[model samples]
Target: MSMARTVSDTRLIFGRYLRQTLRSKVAVVFGLTQPLLYLLLFGPLLTRLGGVRGFGSGDAWQVFVPGVLVQLALFGAAFVGFGLIGDLRSGVVERLRVTPVSRTALLLGRVLRDTVVLVAQAVVLLGAAFALGLRAPAAGVAVGLLFVVGLAVSVASLSYVLAMRTRSEDAFAPLLSAVTLPLMLLSGILLPMGLAPGWLDAVSRCTPFRYVVDAARAAFRGDYATAAVGEGALVTVVLLVVSVALGARRFRAENA
Candidate 1:
């Protein structure tokens, strides 16, 4: 297919899903609830520990808000497969498979919709964080949100691939939970891994999310040139490329 054609198809698919999402205004608002809860309930606790080293150089909100944004992206994008699974069970995918849409567009359109929803939620989370006294350079917050976009794309693409493979909500839910819980804890989304024991911190370093979290914190501190930022950007690019490739290939196979 021509690139133009593919782009058109992607836009069409994206518009369809986005409209569906926008119609349910409550979902968009409710989506921010989890991160907001953490900001309201858990964030203040970090205020007292602001003097503690390894929580990053900024105030507690600075260190913590970035982590929560990442958490929002990590958890929010991770389970998007549930929607895909529903589409599969309801014959949505079966219907699309017979369409003339570019196979890559079929995947990209869905992932892009997910990316938009996640970025919006991240913005709302940031606003709440600001109201609650989180402060960071605007440029740094923008960089952090860019990271959220990359993470959302990577995770959501892989999620769609998994949903297609399993095709069963019962099996998919447990399997996804088993995988995401570990990634969440190890990624230091709620607390700095610096607070972890030596062995635990070492293990966390092995997770790609650790670097991403560290990068966001550094960015929030307005230190953009740091090694953490470079590493996180590199990891995000690598994961995004790999995951999108796998997702596109799966879409092609399924639609073939």
Candidate 2:
């Protein structure tokens, strides 16, 4: 009964945000533009430079598109907290605080909305990638999309928790950048970490995002049953659990 109530509450809140998003068609278009630009401009250049030492398999888009898709989730979902900060500043969160909705639902609704938006953006990214010579199996693309959603859930939940903690976009931006940049640089999103210096490659192994990128690459190669996929799934599950727990706790505290 408790779980059912929370699910119902989450559905209502999700519907509210979904309607707001639909009312702003430009948001949909612009949200995907960056990834599309990378697909168009950067993708071909990588293909041209496939002879470089760091390039993998010479199927450049196959290598590049998975990274770009994960990059899309990395940068996009990590900053979703900005919206929560806006809600707090405008007293919107406070209004919701007085309601009977489950605190978990409050956070899940927003993260779920982010997940939906990111998935849509991923679809656009995949389409552009296909047109640009990406040739992954359909199952691989579907699995990659699933990973994107898992990533969205984890990252957006943490973003909301950070928003609740900092309560200011100005402060959140720097802190988020500090974390995101290191993760991006070390995760081999633009290039495989194997090409990095031995020390740098060793360091990247410590970052969870690298596992995700590797798993996506493997899936792109149609290696669904590999150890990389298993490890990636494990990391994502752990991340989602931890992030949702922390986000829900913060939301509950705010309401209390």
lDDT by residue for model 1 over 1-256, one digit each (tens)? Answer: 8999889999988998899889987877887899899999999999999878776667899889988998888888888898889888889888987878898998999988999999888878888899999889999999988887898899999899999899899989998999888998999999999889999999999888888888888998899999999999999899899999999999999443
lDDT of 2 by residue, 148-230 (tens): 77887899999898888899988999999999999988989888876899899889989988888888888888899999789
Best by TM-score: 1
Candidate 1: C-alpha lDDT: 0.89
Q: Evaluate model 2: give its TM-score.
A: 0.94
Off by over 4 Å in 1: 254-256
Which consecutive 10 residues in model 1 have the weakest lDDT in total?
50-59
Model 2 worst lDDT window (10 residues): 49-58
Model 1, position 67: C-alpha lDDT score: 88
